[model samples]
Target: MKKLLLDLCSKLEGRGIHEIIDRLKLYYRYLITVLFYKPFIGEMGKKTVIYSPIRFTGLKFIYLGAKVTIFDGARIEVVDRYGNQRFSPCLKIGEGTSINQNCHITCAEEIVIGMNVLITANVTITDIIHPYDDINVPISRQPLITKKVYIGDETCIYQNAVILPGAKIGKHCIIGANSVVNIQVPDYSVVVGNPARIVRQYNQMLQSWEKIYQ
Candidate 1:
């Protein structure tokens, strides 16, 4: 009887029960988003949806455009370091954008995401860098270095990408998975790798993407 019970426990742990719990969590998140969360955001537009288990700080500085959908586990924080309105419009998400699960976007100065942007899971977009200039003070306590990040219209950022301060991603750009973007990417360009580089660009004449050598 003890052996049967142990087997049952192992089987249950390896199967259906875990999946059921996960599904339940997802549904609950969706429900909370629909019923409670969306209304609290400033400048939240029509047909916008935010799945719950999401965290936000400084909602007044954050703006969401129409038809934006934010998936579960997103952290959209507009940090006012000294708890003041010194930084206004810290974050702006344009129309028809969709941000996938576990994405983190923390804006100190400004981070503008333009229309129809698609950001996949585990992406991090930040406009502030923690200062390490003062050795006397801890890095966490030191003043932040703020810069504006602009993600232009129709940009697509894949999973595990990091868009750092001063990143200017132009319209219709594609940022590859696991890439770290810190520079300007031109319109209709495709970038990939640790320090992202433009590997391809859209050729208007051919209406296709042409490879960029070196």
Candidate 2:
């Protein structure tokens, strides 16, 4: 009888030790991704969802419904009001979208991003607006901020582009690399050049973007 009891104790101890090791592996993986790599999201229109690669701290994460994809060494900040103010502040995205390496996405008011969007490396999307009317205050410190930014579905924004506030890119649009979107680009348009101009419109019949020669 005593021998039987001893055997059962040994088996229980082994199982308990194995469970601890498994839990440690999961924790280690989460830590590595949050520290070194970026995370992706599922879907939402309010806040951006970050599945992996979460930062250690200084992450507001207010707008979490949007499907946000983070690449390696990307920095994300979401800041909103505590009480019931004018705006709650959110960065929203639709389903089936992703972002590439080394990007920075920050918002204070509200940003709406549609589904099936592809963002390349070193892209910056911010909702904070800066005022140029005042010469006394620096551009960064001006209080006169603008509205939010919106990116439609099935849109492809290339590398090194900056999408500022109060600018809206419609659905099925392609934004060129190294471009600064200062104004609104209509739906189904191919935008290029600095302060991005609509070079062409997408033809639904061809399933490709057509050039505007005229």
Candidate 3:
């Protein structure tokens, strides 16, 4: 199959056949994805494209809005049960949100990502935290603490950023690469650092992003 594709590509080098082939492949993949996952997903809107090789758990607890694109190698897990505890978890991805490759979203309670949010590669968003308060029990066996996470509309979370439990990122915010956000982020702000802090904020009157002195 590889040899045949290579030979075909060589033969059709300059005839714009490559683009046609690519589109066909994409359409085929989309069809396959919908057929395989649609039955299990609780609510999946039209034209939501989920690429191949995704690790999904509790599909019935996940809701995807229209035109949401989840790239390859993404892991979306909704944990409904942990030991004897049970949760009614919901993971909602709003319309036009694009979650890039290798992104991991784990929700035990609720995680709501608003419309047009851009989550770049390798980002991790989770609403559950593992507690190690007990020395007698293993950390993994301990009860989990969960909080609701919210990423507002038009927010951009860059590569390798971690949105931890109870994070409330406001609309049009920019979460910088490699940042760890665990608290509330005001609207139209640029945050960056280990424990992410606002470095700039959009001045509506001036229509510009001004550096925050603090």
Note each model's CA RMSD in angstroms: 9.2, 9.8, 5.2
Instruction: Supply candidate 2's per-residue lDDT for 210.
Output: 73
lDDT of 2 at 26: 44
Between prediction 1 and prediction 3, the one with superior lDDT is 3
lDDT per residue (tens digit) for residues 1-214 in model 1: 4764465456557557778576555555545655676666677786676775377788778788888888879898888764333555468999999999999998989899999999999999999888798899888777677889999999999999999999999999999999999999999999999988999999999999999997
List, residue by residue over 126-209, the lDDT tens digit for candidate 3.
999999999999999999999999999999999999999999999999999999999899999999999888999999999999
State residue 9's C-alpha deviation in candidate 2, in Å. 30
TM-score of each: 0.81, 0.65, 0.91
lDDT for 66 in candidate 1 is 85
Ranking of candidates on TM-score, top first: 3, 1, 2
Residue lDDT tens for model 2, 22-135: 645544444454443334322223223333433422233432333454455666666554224234566665666777777777777777878889988888888876567889
Backbone N/Cα/C clashes per model = 0, 9, 0
Looking at model 1, residue 128 earns an lDDT score of: 86
lDDT of 3: 0.92
What does candidate 1 score on TM? Answer: 0.81
- Pitting candidate 1 against candidate 2, the one with the higher lDDT is 1
